[model samples]
Target: METIHLTYPETPDVVPSVMVLGFFDGVHTGHQAVIRHAQEQAERLNVPVTVVTFDPHPKQVLSNKPDAVRYITPLSRKLKRIESLGVERCLVLTFTKELAGLSPQQFVDDYLIGAGAVHVTAGFDYSYGKFGEGTMETMPFHARGRFTTSVVNEQTEGGEKVSSTRIRKLLGAGEVDAAATLLGSPYVICGEVIHGDARGRTIGYPTANVVMDASYVMPRLGVYATRVRLRDGRTFHAMTNVGRRPTFYDTGDVSIESHLFDFSEDLYGQLIEIEWVRFIRNERAFDGLDSLIAQLKQDETTARSILS
Candidate 1:
Protein backbone atom coordinates (compact mmCIF):
# COMPACT_ATOMS: atom_id res chain seq x y z
CA MET A 1 0.00 0.00 0.00
CA GLU A 2 1.18 3.53 -0.81
CA THR A 3 0.99 6.27 1.85
CA ILE A 4 0.55 9.91 0.83
CA HIS A 5 0.67 12.73 3.35
CA LEU A 6 -1.13 15.97 2.57
CA THR A 7 -1.76 19.29 4.23
CA TYR A 8 -4.65 21.64 3.50
CA PRO A 9 -4.31 23.91 0.43
CA GLU A 10 -2.16 21.17 -1.08
CA THR A 11 -3.48 18.46 -3.39
CA PRO A 12 -2.13 15.34 -5.01
CA ASP A 13 -2.59 14.18 -8.57
CA VAL A 14 -4.47 10.92 -8.33
CA VAL A 15 -6.70 8.46 -10.14
CA PRO A 16 -10.48 8.02 -9.79
CA SER A 17 -10.98 5.77 -6.77
CA VAL A 18 -13.38 4.73 -4.06
CA MET A 19 -12.44 6.86 -1.07
CA VAL A 20 -12.83 5.42 2.46
CA LEU A 21 -12.90 8.26 4.95
CA GLY A 22 -12.43 8.23 8.73
CA PHE A 23 -9.97 8.93 11.54
CA PHE A 24 -9.60 5.23 12.03
CA ASP A 25 -7.80 5.22 15.40
CA GLY A 26 -8.03 1.55 16.24
CA VAL A 27 -9.27 0.14 12.95
CA HIS A 28 -11.65 -1.83 15.14
CA THR A 29 -14.53 -3.96 13.91
CA GLY A 30 -16.86 -1.08 12.95
CA HIS A 31 -14.10 0.71 11.05
CA GLN A 32 -13.31 -2.58 9.39
CA ALA A 33 -16.88 -2.81 8.14
CA VAL A 34 -16.67 0.65 6.58
CA ILE A 35 -13.35 -0.11 4.89
CA ARG A 36 -14.63 -3.48 3.70
CA HIS A 37 -17.68 -1.81 2.23
CA ALA A 38 -15.43 0.59 0.37
CA GLN A 39 -13.37 -2.36 -0.80
CA GLU A 40 -16.52 -3.92 -2.24
CA GLN A 41 -17.35 -0.66 -3.99
CA ALA A 42 -13.83 -0.45 -5.39
CA GLU A 43 -14.10 -4.03 -6.65
CA ARG A 44 -17.35 -3.27 -8.42
CA LEU A 45 -16.07 -0.03 -9.96
CA ASN A 46 -12.64 -1.51 -10.78
CA VAL A 47 -10.97 1.38 -8.96
CA PRO A 48 -8.36 1.43 -6.21
CA VAL A 49 -9.52 2.00 -2.65
CA THR A 50 -7.96 5.07 -1.08
CA VAL A 51 -8.27 5.30 2.70
CA VAL A 52 -8.40 8.91 3.90
CA THR A 53 -7.54 9.49 7.59
CA PHE A 54 -6.38 12.32 9.79
CA ASP A 55 -3.38 12.41 12.11
CA PRO A 56 -2.77 13.62 15.76
CA HIS A 57 -6.56 13.31 16.09
CA PRO A 58 -8.87 16.24 15.43
CA LYS A 59 -9.66 16.45 19.15
CA GLN A 60 -6.02 17.07 20.01
CA VAL A 61 -5.88 20.00 17.61
CA LEU A 62 -9.38 21.38 18.18
CA SER A 63 -9.99 20.91 21.87
CA ASN A 64 -9.63 23.97 24.08
CA LYS A 65 -8.16 22.12 27.01
CA PRO A 66 -4.67 20.57 26.89
CA ASP A 67 -6.14 17.13 26.88
CA ALA A 68 -3.95 14.34 25.50
CA VAL A 69 -6.16 11.99 23.58
CA ARG A 70 -4.78 8.48 23.79
CA TYR A 71 -4.98 6.23 20.76
CA ILE A 72 -5.68 2.53 20.37
CA THR A 73 -3.43 2.31 17.33
CA PRO A 74 -0.94 5.05 16.45
CA LEU A 75 -0.55 6.26 12.85
CA SER A 76 1.99 3.63 11.79
CA ARG A 77 0.00 0.76 13.26
CA LYS A 78 -3.22 2.14 11.82
CA LEU A 79 -1.73 2.15 8.32
CA LYS A 80 -0.59 -1.43 8.80
CA ARG A 81 -4.08 -2.49 9.76
CA ILE A 82 -5.62 -0.66 6.81
CA GLU A 83 -3.15 -2.31 4.46
CA SER A 84 -4.10 -5.70 5.86
CA LEU A 85 -7.64 -4.94 4.68
CA GLY A 86 -6.32 -4.72 1.10
CA VAL A 87 -6.44 -0.96 0.67
CA GLU A 88 -4.34 0.23 -2.27
CA ARG A 89 -3.64 3.74 -1.04
CA CYS A 90 -3.69 5.65 2.25
CA LEU A 91 -3.97 9.45 2.22
CA VAL A 92 -3.04 10.94 5.59
CA LEU A 93 -4.42 14.46 5.79
CA THR A 94 -2.58 16.57 8.29
CA PHE A 95 -5.25 18.11 10.49
CA THR A 96 -4.76 21.79 11.18
CA LYS A 97 -6.70 24.91 12.11
CA GLU A 98 -6.95 25.90 8.43
CA LEU A 99 -8.27 22.53 7.30
CA ALA A 100 -10.74 22.52 10.19
CA GLY A 101 -12.17 25.85 9.05
CA LEU A 102 -13.33 24.73 5.60
CA SER A 103 -17.05 24.72 4.94
CA PRO A 104 -18.92 21.58 3.90
CA GLN A 105 -18.89 22.47 0.19
CA GLN A 106 -15.25 23.54 0.16
CA PHE A 107 -14.11 20.40 1.94
CA VAL A 108 -15.84 18.16 -0.54
CA ASP A 109 -14.67 20.17 -3.49
CA ASP A 110 -11.08 20.20 -2.37
CA TYR A 111 -10.75 16.79 -0.73
CA LEU A 112 -13.21 14.60 -2.63
CA ILE A 113 -14.42 15.70 -6.04
CA GLY A 114 -11.23 17.59 -6.83
CA ALA A 115 -9.10 14.62 -5.87
CA GLY A 116 -10.73 12.15 -8.24
CA ALA A 117 -13.07 10.56 -5.78
CA VAL A 118 -15.57 8.70 -7.95
CA HIS A 119 -17.31 7.26 -4.90
CA VAL A 120 -17.01 7.73 -1.12
CA THR A 121 -17.67 5.31 1.73
CA ALA A 122 -17.88 6.22 5.40
CA GLY A 123 -19.62 5.22 8.58
CA PHE A 124 -23.13 6.50 9.19
CA ASP A 125 -22.01 8.90 11.90
CA TYR A 126 -19.03 10.37 10.00
CA SER A 127 -18.86 14.15 9.98
CA TYR A 128 -16.73 16.82 8.31
CA GLY A 129 -16.32 20.59 7.73
CA LYS A 130 -16.19 23.42 10.28
CA PHE A 131 -17.52 22.28 13.66
CA GLY A 132 -18.56 19.00 12.01
CA GLU A 133 -21.58 20.53 10.33
CA GLY A 134 -21.36 18.00 7.52
CA THR A 135 -22.48 14.45 8.21
CA MET A 136 -23.28 11.37 6.21
CA GLU A 137 -26.78 12.80 5.73
CA THR A 138 -25.29 15.85 4.00
CA MET A 139 -22.45 14.10 2.15
CA PRO A 140 -24.45 13.58 -1.03
CA PHE A 141 -25.57 17.22 -1.09
CA HIS A 142 -21.99 18.34 -0.59
CA ALA A 143 -20.91 16.01 -3.39
CA ARG A 144 -22.84 18.27 -5.81
CA GLY A 145 -23.39 15.27 -8.14
CA ARG A 146 -19.67 14.88 -8.61
CA PHE A 147 -19.45 11.64 -6.65
CA THR A 148 -21.65 8.99 -5.02
CA THR A 149 -21.73 8.15 -1.31
CA SER A 150 -22.29 5.04 0.74
CA VAL A 151 -22.90 4.92 4.51
CA VAL A 152 -22.18 1.78 6.48
CA ASN A 153 -24.53 1.81 9.41
CA GLU A 154 -23.52 1.27 13.03
CA GLN A 155 -21.89 -2.13 13.51
CA THR A 156 -22.61 -3.85 16.80
CA GLU A 157 -21.42 -6.75 18.92
CA GLY A 158 -23.53 -8.34 21.65
CA GLY A 159 -26.35 -5.85 21.04
CA GLU A 160 -23.98 -2.94 21.64
CA LYS A 161 -22.24 -0.70 19.18
CA VAL A 162 -18.66 -1.65 18.35
CA SER A 163 -16.73 1.59 18.71
CA SER A 164 -13.25 2.86 19.53
CA THR A 165 -14.47 4.78 22.56
CA ARG A 166 -16.06 1.66 23.97
CA ILE A 167 -12.88 -0.31 23.35
CA ARG A 168 -10.81 2.33 25.10
CA LYS A 169 -13.12 2.26 28.07
CA LEU A 170 -12.78 -1.52 28.21
CA LEU A 171 -9.00 -1.26 28.19
CA GLY A 172 -9.13 1.45 30.80
CA ALA A 173 -11.24 -0.78 33.00
CA GLY A 174 -8.84 -3.75 32.41
CA GLU A 175 -11.41 -5.80 30.54
CA VAL A 176 -9.15 -6.77 27.66
CA ASP A 177 -10.95 -10.03 26.89
CA ALA A 178 -14.19 -8.13 26.40
CA ALA A 179 -12.40 -5.43 24.42
CA ALA A 180 -10.92 -8.08 22.13
CA THR A 181 -14.42 -9.38 21.43
CA LEU A 182 -15.45 -5.98 20.11
CA LEU A 183 -12.13 -5.26 18.38
CA GLY A 184 -12.19 -8.65 16.55
CA SER A 185 -8.65 -9.10 17.79
CA PRO A 186 -6.47 -8.52 20.82
CA TYR A 187 -5.53 -4.96 21.70
CA VAL A 188 -1.84 -4.33 21.00
CA ILE A 189 0.70 -1.72 22.07
CA CYS A 190 4.15 -1.24 20.53
CA GLY A 191 7.15 -0.25 22.60
CA GLU A 192 10.91 -0.52 22.90
CA VAL A 193 12.65 -2.61 25.50
CA ILE A 194 14.39 -0.38 27.98
CA HIS A 195 16.66 -0.90 30.99
CA GLY A 196 15.05 -1.45 34.35
CA ASP A 197 16.34 -2.08 37.91
CA ALA A 198 16.61 -5.81 37.20
CA ARG A 199 14.55 -6.42 40.33
CA GLY A 200 12.65 -9.27 38.67
CA ARG A 201 15.93 -11.08 38.04
CA THR A 202 16.64 -11.07 41.77
CA ILE A 203 13.32 -12.87 42.20
CA GLY A 204 14.04 -15.54 39.56
CA TYR A 205 11.60 -13.88 37.07
CA PRO A 206 13.50 -11.47 34.90
CA THR A 207 11.41 -9.02 32.85
CA ALA A 208 11.88 -6.69 29.92
CA ASN A 209 10.81 -3.11 30.55
CA VAL A 210 8.77 -1.98 27.55
CA VAL A 211 8.67 1.78 27.21
CA MET A 212 5.89 2.95 24.94
CA ASP A 213 4.85 6.23 23.37
CA ALA A 214 2.62 8.31 25.60
CA SER A 215 -0.02 8.54 22.86
CA TYR A 216 -0.79 4.83 23.01
CA VAL A 217 -3.65 3.88 25.31
CA MET A 218 -2.48 1.77 28.25
CA PRO A 219 -4.41 -1.11 29.62
CA ARG A 220 -5.48 -0.96 33.26
CA LEU A 221 -2.73 -1.14 35.88
CA GLY A 222 -2.56 -4.86 36.40
CA VAL A 223 -1.00 -8.06 35.15
CA TYR A 224 -2.27 -9.62 31.94
CA ALA A 225 -1.73 -12.54 29.65
CA THR A 226 -0.05 -11.19 26.54
CA ARG A 227 1.78 -12.27 23.43
CA VAL A 228 4.98 -10.43 22.60
CA ARG A 229 6.17 -10.19 19.00
CA LEU A 230 9.62 -8.92 18.08
CA ARG A 231 10.34 -6.95 14.92
CA ASP A 232 12.00 -10.03 13.46
CA GLY A 233 8.66 -11.89 13.73
CA ARG A 234 9.60 -14.01 16.72
CA THR A 235 6.72 -14.32 19.20
CA PHE A 236 6.37 -15.66 22.70
CA HIS A 237 3.79 -16.14 25.38
CA ALA A 238 4.34 -13.66 28.18
CA MET A 239 2.88 -12.32 31.41
CA THR A 240 2.93 -8.54 31.47
CA ASN A 241 2.54 -6.20 34.41
CA VAL A 242 1.40 -2.61 34.08
CA GLY A 243 1.90 -0.90 37.39
CA ARG A 244 4.01 1.37 39.60
CA ARG A 245 5.69 -1.49 41.49
CA PRO A 246 4.12 -0.63 44.80
CA THR A 247 5.55 -3.81 46.22
CA PHE A 248 9.07 -2.39 45.92
CA TYR A 249 8.45 1.29 46.52
CA ASP A 250 5.88 3.55 48.06
CA THR A 251 5.64 5.50 44.83
CA GLY A 252 7.21 5.04 41.38
CA ASP A 253 6.57 5.58 37.73
CA VAL A 254 4.07 3.27 36.09
CA SER A 255 5.85 0.62 34.05
CA ILE A 256 5.18 -2.21 31.60
CA GLU A 257 7.29 -5.23 32.50
CA SER A 258 6.85 -8.51 30.70
CA HIS A 259 8.38 -11.86 31.70
CA LEU A 260 8.53 -13.98 28.59
CA PHE A 261 8.24 -17.66 29.37
CA ASP A 262 11.40 -19.60 28.58
CA PHE A 263 13.07 -16.54 27.08
CA SER A 264 16.79 -16.11 27.66
CA GLU A 265 18.12 -13.83 24.89
CA ASP A 266 18.70 -10.16 25.60
CA LEU A 267 16.04 -7.74 24.25
CA TYR A 268 17.36 -4.36 25.33
CA GLY A 269 16.82 -1.61 22.78
CA GLN A 270 14.68 -3.95 20.63
CA LEU A 271 11.14 -3.03 19.65
CA ILE A 272 8.28 -5.34 20.53
CA GLU A 273 4.55 -5.47 20.26
CA ILE A 274 2.49 -6.67 23.20
CA GLU A 275 -0.95 -8.07 22.46
CA TRP A 276 -3.11 -7.88 25.58
CA VAL A 277 -5.12 -11.08 25.92
CA ARG A 278 -6.69 -11.43 29.37
CA PHE A 279 -6.70 -9.45 32.56
CA ILE A 280 -5.16 -11.41 35.43
CA ARG A 281 -5.51 -9.42 38.63
CA ASN A 282 -5.22 -5.99 40.06
CA GLU A 283 -1.76 -4.79 41.02
CA ARG A 284 -1.13 -4.63 44.74
CA ALA A 285 1.64 -4.19 47.24
CA PHE A 286 2.87 -7.31 48.98
CA ASP A 287 4.21 -7.22 52.50
CA GLY A 288 7.37 -9.17 51.75
CA LEU A 289 9.52 -10.51 48.94
CA ASP A 290 8.55 -14.11 49.65
CA SER A 291 4.87 -13.26 49.30
CA LEU A 292 5.49 -11.42 46.04
CA ILE A 293 7.46 -14.35 44.69
CA ALA A 294 4.65 -16.76 45.55
CA GLN A 295 2.12 -14.52 43.82
CA LEU A 296 4.39 -14.23 40.81
CA LYS A 297 4.47 -18.01 40.61
CA GLN A 298 0.70 -18.14 40.79
CA ASP A 299 0.39 -15.42 38.16
CA GLU A 300 2.66 -17.36 35.86
CA THR A 301 0.45 -20.43 36.24
CA THR A 302 -2.72 -18.50 35.55
CA ALA A 303 -1.20 -16.57 32.65
CA ARG A 304 0.13 -19.76 31.12
CA SER A 305 -3.31 -21.35 31.33
CA ILE A 306 -4.91 -18.35 29.67
CA LEU A 307 -2.24 -17.90 27.01
CA SER A 308 -2.25 -21.60 26.17
Candidate 2:
Protein backbone atom coordinates (compact mmCIF):
# COMPACT_ATOMS: atom_id res chain seq x y z
CA MET A 1 0.00 0.00 0.00
CA GLU A 2 1.17 3.57 -0.67
CA THR A 3 1.10 5.16 2.79
CA ILE A 4 1.58 8.89 3.21
CA HIS A 5 1.65 11.40 6.04
CA LEU A 6 -0.61 14.37 5.38
CA THR A 7 -0.93 17.84 6.84
CA TYR A 8 -3.28 20.74 6.18
CA PRO A 9 -2.29 22.74 3.05
CA GLU A 10 0.20 19.97 2.22
CA THR A 11 -2.31 17.38 1.04
CA PRO A 12 -1.53 14.92 -1.75
CA ASP A 13 -2.49 15.48 -5.38
CA VAL A 14 -4.43 12.19 -5.66
CA VAL A 15 -8.13 12.71 -6.18
CA PRO A 16 -11.48 11.01 -6.73
CA SER A 17 -10.36 8.23 -4.36
CA VAL A 18 -12.39 6.15 -1.95
CA MET A 19 -11.22 6.90 1.59
CA VAL A 20 -11.72 5.30 4.98
CA LEU A 21 -11.12 7.50 8.03
CA GLY A 22 -10.87 6.81 11.76
CA PHE A 23 -8.45 6.10 14.58
CA PHE A 24 -8.51 2.38 13.61
CA ASP A 25 -6.68 1.69 16.85
CA GLY A 26 -6.71 -2.09 16.80
CA VAL A 27 -8.15 -2.42 13.30
CA HIS A 28 -10.79 -4.61 14.97
CA THR A 29 -13.59 -6.36 13.10
CA GLY A 30 -15.68 -3.20 12.98
CA HIS A 31 -12.77 -1.20 11.57
CA GLN A 32 -12.22 -3.98 9.05
CA ALA A 33 -15.81 -3.80 7.87
CA VAL A 34 -15.48 -0.10 7.15
CA ILE A 35 -12.16 -0.63 5.35
CA ARG A 36 -13.68 -3.49 3.36
CA HIS A 37 -16.60 -1.31 2.34
CA ALA A 38 -14.22 1.42 1.19
CA GLN A 39 -12.11 -1.05 -0.74
CA GLU A 40 -15.18 -2.53 -2.40
CA GLN A 41 -16.41 0.91 -3.29
CA ALA A 42 -13.02 1.83 -4.69
CA GLU A 43 -12.97 -1.31 -6.82
CA ARG A 44 -16.40 -0.51 -8.18
CA LEU A 45 -15.41 3.10 -8.93
CA ASN A 46 -12.03 2.09 -10.35
CA VAL A 47 -10.17 4.32 -7.90
CA PRO A 48 -7.52 3.84 -5.27
CA VAL A 49 -8.50 2.70 -1.74
CA THR A 50 -7.04 5.12 0.75
CA VAL A 51 -7.21 5.08 4.54
CA VAL A 52 -7.05 8.26 6.63
CA THR A 53 -6.00 8.02 10.24
CA PHE A 54 -4.34 10.15 12.89
CA ASP A 55 -1.13 9.78 14.82
CA PRO A 56 -0.89 10.26 18.64
CA HIS A 57 -4.64 9.62 18.85
CA PRO A 58 -6.84 12.68 19.20
CA LYS A 59 -7.79 11.55 22.67
CA GLN A 60 -4.19 12.13 23.70
CA VAL A 61 -4.49 15.71 22.56
CA LEU A 62 -7.94 16.38 23.96
CA SER A 63 -7.82 14.50 27.24
CA ASN A 64 -6.66 16.04 30.48
CA LYS A 65 -5.12 12.76 31.49
CA PRO A 66 -3.69 11.90 28.09
CA ASP A 67 -0.77 10.03 29.59
CA ALA A 68 -3.08 7.61 31.37
CA VAL A 69 -4.98 6.55 28.26
CA ARG A 70 -3.58 3.40 26.67
CA TYR A 71 -3.78 2.23 23.08
CA ILE A 72 -4.85 -1.12 21.62
CA THR A 73 -2.17 -0.99 18.94
CA PRO A 74 0.77 1.37 18.66
CA LEU A 75 1.16 3.31 15.39
CA SER A 76 3.62 0.83 13.91
CA ARG A 77 1.38 -2.15 14.61
CA LYS A 78 -1.72 -0.30 13.44
CA LEU A 79 -0.04 0.52 10.13
CA LYS A 80 1.04 -3.07 9.64
CA ARG A 81 -2.47 -4.36 10.34
CA ILE A 82 -4.06 -1.80 8.03
CA GLU A 83 -1.54 -2.58 5.26
CA SER A 84 -2.37 -6.26 5.67
CA LEU A 85 -5.99 -5.43 4.77
CA GLY A 86 -4.90 -4.61 1.17
CA VAL A 87 -5.73 -0.92 1.10
CA GLU A 88 -3.95 0.90 -1.73
CA ARG A 89 -2.74 3.69 0.51
CA CYS A 90 -2.82 4.95 4.11
CA LEU A 91 -2.54 8.57 5.24
CA VAL A 92 -1.53 9.39 8.79
CA LEU A 93 -2.36 12.92 9.86
CA THR A 94 -0.55 14.47 12.76
CA PHE A 95 -3.10 15.77 15.22
CA THR A 96 -2.22 19.16 16.64
CA LYS A 97 -3.92 22.03 18.46
CA GLU A 98 -4.15 24.06 15.27
CA LEU A 99 -5.53 21.17 13.25
CA ALA A 100 -7.89 20.25 16.07
CA GLY A 101 -9.38 23.72 15.94
CA LEU A 102 -10.67 23.27 12.39
CA SER A 103 -14.44 23.38 12.03
CA PRO A 104 -16.29 20.39 10.59
CA GLN A 105 -16.62 22.04 7.18
CA GLN A 106 -13.03 23.17 7.20
CA PHE A 107 -11.82 19.65 8.01
CA VAL A 108 -13.74 18.33 5.01
CA ASP A 109 -12.44 21.09 2.74
CA ASP A 110 -8.88 20.81 3.98
CA TYR A 111 -8.51 17.03 4.29
CA LEU A 112 -11.26 15.19 2.44
CA ILE A 113 -11.43 17.59 -0.48
CA GLY A 114 -7.73 18.30 -0.45
CA ALA A 115 -6.91 14.59 -0.56
CA GLY A 116 -9.12 14.20 -3.65
CA ALA A 117 -11.58 11.80 -2.04
CA VAL A 118 -14.52 11.13 -4.33
CA HIS A 119 -16.19 9.11 -1.57
CA VAL A 120 -15.58 8.57 2.15
CA THR A 121 -16.39 5.59 4.39
CA ALA A 122 -16.24 5.44 8.15
CA GLY A 123 -17.90 3.82 11.16
CA PHE A 124 -21.37 4.97 12.10
CA ASP A 125 -20.17 6.56 15.33
CA TYR A 126 -17.18 8.29 13.77
CA SER A 127 -16.82 12.03 14.42
CA TYR A 128 -14.33 14.76 13.56
CA GLY A 129 -13.33 18.46 13.86
CA LYS A 130 -12.81 20.65 16.92
CA PHE A 131 -14.80 19.37 19.89
CA GLY A 132 -16.03 16.55 17.62
CA GLU A 133 -18.77 18.59 15.91
CA GLY A 134 -18.75 16.46 12.77
CA THR A 135 -21.36 13.71 12.65
CA MET A 136 -22.98 11.43 10.09
CA GLU A 137 -25.70 13.99 9.65
CA THR A 138 -23.23 16.77 8.90
CA MET A 139 -20.88 14.85 6.58
CA PRO A 140 -22.95 15.03 3.42
CA PHE A 141 -23.48 18.78 3.82
CA HIS A 142 -19.76 19.31 4.31
CA ALA A 143 -18.98 17.16 1.28
CA ARG A 144 -21.53 19.08 -0.81
CA GLY A 145 -20.54 18.56 -4.44
CA ARG A 146 -17.01 17.50 -3.57
CA PHE A 147 -17.59 13.93 -2.38
CA THR A 148 -20.05 11.28 -1.13
CA THR A 149 -20.15 9.75 2.34
CA SER A 150 -21.04 6.26 3.57
CA VAL A 151 -21.31 5.11 7.16
CA VAL A 152 -20.82 1.48 8.19
CA ASN A 153 -22.90 0.36 11.12
CA GLU A 154 -21.32 -0.92 14.30
CA GLN A 155 -20.02 -4.48 13.98
CA THR A 156 -21.26 -6.83 16.68
CA GLU A 157 -19.84 -10.02 18.15
CA GLY A 158 -22.03 -12.12 20.41
CA GLY A 159 -24.56 -9.26 20.54
CA GLU A 160 -22.02 -6.60 21.57
CA LYS A 161 -20.19 -4.05 19.48
CA VAL A 162 -16.58 -4.89 18.78
CA SER A 163 -14.44 -1.93 19.82
CA SER A 164 -10.90 -1.10 20.83
CA THR A 165 -12.07 -0.08 24.32
CA ARG A 166 -13.88 -3.38 24.85
CA ILE A 167 -10.89 -5.33 23.56
CA ARG A 168 -8.58 -3.44 25.91
CA LYS A 169 -10.85 -4.24 28.82
CA LEU A 170 -10.81 -7.91 27.89
CA LEU A 171 -7.03 -7.94 27.63
CA GLY A 172 -6.60 -6.06 30.91
CA ALA A 173 -8.76 -8.70 32.54
CA GLY A 174 -6.67 -11.48 31.02
CA GLU A 175 -9.40 -12.53 28.63
CA VAL A 176 -7.03 -13.23 25.75
CA ASP A 177 -9.41 -15.44 23.80
CA ALA A 178 -12.21 -12.87 23.92
CA ALA A 179 -9.84 -10.07 22.95
CA ALA A 180 -8.63 -12.18 20.03
CA THR A 181 -12.19 -12.65 18.81
CA LEU A 182 -12.70 -8.89 18.77
CA LEU A 183 -9.25 -8.06 17.35
CA GLY A 184 -9.33 -10.79 14.68
CA SER A 185 -5.88 -11.71 15.93
CA PRO A 186 -3.96 -12.29 19.13
CA TYR A 187 -3.22 -9.21 21.28
CA VAL A 188 0.45 -8.42 20.80
CA ILE A 189 2.86 -5.95 22.42
CA CYS A 190 6.12 -5.33 20.63
CA GLY A 191 9.18 -3.39 21.70
CA GLU A 192 12.95 -3.43 21.74
CA VAL A 193 14.74 -5.67 24.24
CA ILE A 194 16.57 -3.72 26.91
CA HIS A 195 19.07 -4.42 29.67
CA GLY A 196 17.64 -5.90 32.82
CA ASP A 197 18.93 -6.98 36.21
CA ALA A 198 19.93 -10.42 34.86
CA ARG A 199 17.94 -12.10 37.63
CA GLY A 200 16.14 -14.55 35.39
CA ARG A 201 19.41 -15.83 33.99
CA THR A 202 20.56 -16.77 37.49
CA ILE A 203 17.48 -18.94 37.77
CA GLY A 204 18.33 -20.92 34.61
CA TYR A 205 15.47 -19.41 32.52
CA PRO A 206 17.01 -16.38 30.90
CA THR A 207 14.41 -13.87 29.75
CA ALA A 208 14.29 -11.12 27.15
CA ASN A 209 13.14 -7.88 28.74
CA VAL A 210 10.75 -5.87 26.61
CA VAL A 211 10.46 -2.15 27.32
CA MET A 212 6.91 -1.38 26.36
CA ASP A 213 6.02 2.08 25.06
CA ALA A 214 3.43 4.03 27.05
CA SER A 215 0.98 4.09 24.15
CA TYR A 216 0.31 0.34 24.12
CA VAL A 217 -2.15 -1.19 26.56
CA MET A 218 -0.67 -3.77 28.88
CA PRO A 219 -2.39 -6.99 29.81
CA ARG A 220 -3.11 -8.07 33.35
CA LEU A 221 -0.06 -8.57 35.53
CA GLY A 222 0.63 -12.29 35.60
CA VAL A 223 2.18 -15.13 33.70
CA TYR A 224 0.85 -16.04 30.28
CA ALA A 225 1.39 -18.42 27.39
CA THR A 226 2.76 -16.37 24.51
CA ARG A 227 4.31 -16.53 21.09
CA VAL A 228 7.39 -14.36 20.60
CA ARG A 229 8.23 -13.11 17.11
CA LEU A 230 11.75 -11.84 16.66
CA ARG A 231 13.03 -9.14 14.34
CA ASP A 232 13.94 -11.87 11.84
CA GLY A 233 10.22 -12.84 11.85
CA ARG A 234 10.74 -16.26 13.42
CA THR A 235 8.14 -17.00 16.08
CA PHE A 236 8.66 -19.11 19.20
CA HIS A 237 6.31 -20.36 21.87
CA ALA A 238 7.19 -18.76 25.19
CA MET A 239 6.16 -17.88 28.72
CA THR A 240 5.74 -14.22 29.68
CA ASN A 241 5.43 -12.31 32.93
CA VAL A 242 4.16 -8.76 33.56
CA GLY A 243 4.97 -7.59 37.02
CA ARG A 244 7.59 -6.57 39.50
CA ARG A 245 9.69 -9.24 41.25
CA PRO A 246 8.12 -8.94 44.66
CA THR A 247 10.01 -12.00 45.88
CA PHE A 248 13.34 -10.40 45.17
CA TYR A 249 12.66 -6.74 46.01
CA ASP A 250 9.98 -4.16 45.49
CA THR A 251 11.09 -1.91 42.64
CA GLY A 252 7.50 -1.22 41.65
CA ASP A 253 8.31 -0.95 37.97
CA VAL A 254 5.99 -3.04 35.82
CA SER A 255 8.17 -5.10 33.51
CA ILE A 256 7.26 -7.43 30.65
CA GLU A 257 9.71 -10.31 30.67
CA SER A 258 9.52 -13.31 28.35
CA HIS A 259 11.36 -16.60 28.39
CA LEU A 260 11.54 -18.23 24.95
CA PHE A 261 11.11 -21.95 25.64
CA ASP A 262 14.21 -24.02 24.81
CA PHE A 263 15.65 -21.06 22.91
CA SER A 264 18.70 -19.06 23.88
CA GLU A 265 20.50 -16.33 21.94
CA ASP A 266 21.59 -12.71 22.37
CA LEU A 267 18.45 -10.59 21.97
CA TYR A 268 19.26 -7.24 23.52
CA GLY A 269 18.33 -4.25 21.34
CA GLN A 270 16.33 -6.46 18.96
CA LEU A 271 12.63 -5.85 18.44
CA ILE A 272 10.40 -8.62 19.79
CA GLU A 273 6.68 -9.04 19.49
CA ILE A 274 4.88 -10.98 22.22
CA GLU A 275 1.47 -12.44 21.48
CA TRP A 276 -0.61 -13.43 24.46
CA VAL A 277 -2.37 -16.79 24.04
CA ARG A 278 -3.71 -17.58 27.53
CA PHE A 279 -3.60 -16.41 31.07
CA ILE A 280 -1.84 -18.74 33.49
CA ARG A 281 -1.95 -17.08 36.90
CA ASN A 282 -1.85 -13.69 38.61
CA GLU A 283 1.53 -12.39 39.70
CA ARG A 284 2.40 -13.07 43.33
CA ALA A 285 5.26 -12.79 45.73
CA PHE A 286 7.09 -16.00 46.45
CA ASP A 287 8.86 -16.99 49.64
CA GLY A 288 12.29 -17.09 48.05
CA LEU A 289 14.31 -17.46 44.85
CA ASP A 290 13.93 -21.23 44.88
CA SER A 291 10.15 -21.02 45.16
CA LEU A 292 9.95 -18.47 42.34
CA ILE A 293 12.22 -20.60 40.15
CA ALA A 294 10.05 -23.66 40.78
CA GLN A 295 6.90 -21.78 39.86
CA LEU A 296 8.58 -20.46 36.70
CA LYS A 297 9.43 -24.00 35.65
CA GLN A 298 5.80 -24.99 36.19
CA ASP A 299 4.65 -21.97 34.23
CA GLU A 300 6.98 -22.92 31.38
CA THR A 301 5.41 -26.36 31.19
CA THR A 302 1.92 -24.93 31.23
CA ALA A 303 2.82 -22.43 28.53
CA ARG A 304 4.29 -25.12 26.29
CA SER A 305 1.18 -27.29 26.73
CA ILE A 306 -1.13 -24.37 25.95
CA LEU A 307 0.88 -23.33 22.89
CA SER A 308 0.95 -26.98 21.72
**Tens-digit lDDT track of model 2 for 56-167:** 8887878898888788888888999999999878888888887899999988888889879999989999888888899877899999778888899989999998998899
In model 2, how many backbone clashes occur?
A: 0
* TM-score between model 1 and native: 0.98
Q: Which ten residues in a row have the lowest lDDT in candidate 1?
A: 59-68
| CA deviation > 4 Å runs, candidate 2 | none
Residue 117 of model 1: what lDDT? Answer: 98
Question: Which candidate wins on lDDT?
Answer: 1
| Stretches > 4 Å off in candidate 1 | none
Q: What digit string (tens of lDDT, one per residue) describes model 1 on residues 1-308?
A: 99999998897676799998999988999999999999899999999999989987988898885367889998999999999988999989999999999998898898888889999989999999999999999999999998999999999998999999999999999999999888778999998999999989988999999999547888999999999998899999999999999988899888999999999999999999999999999999999999999999999999999988
Clashing pairs in 2: none
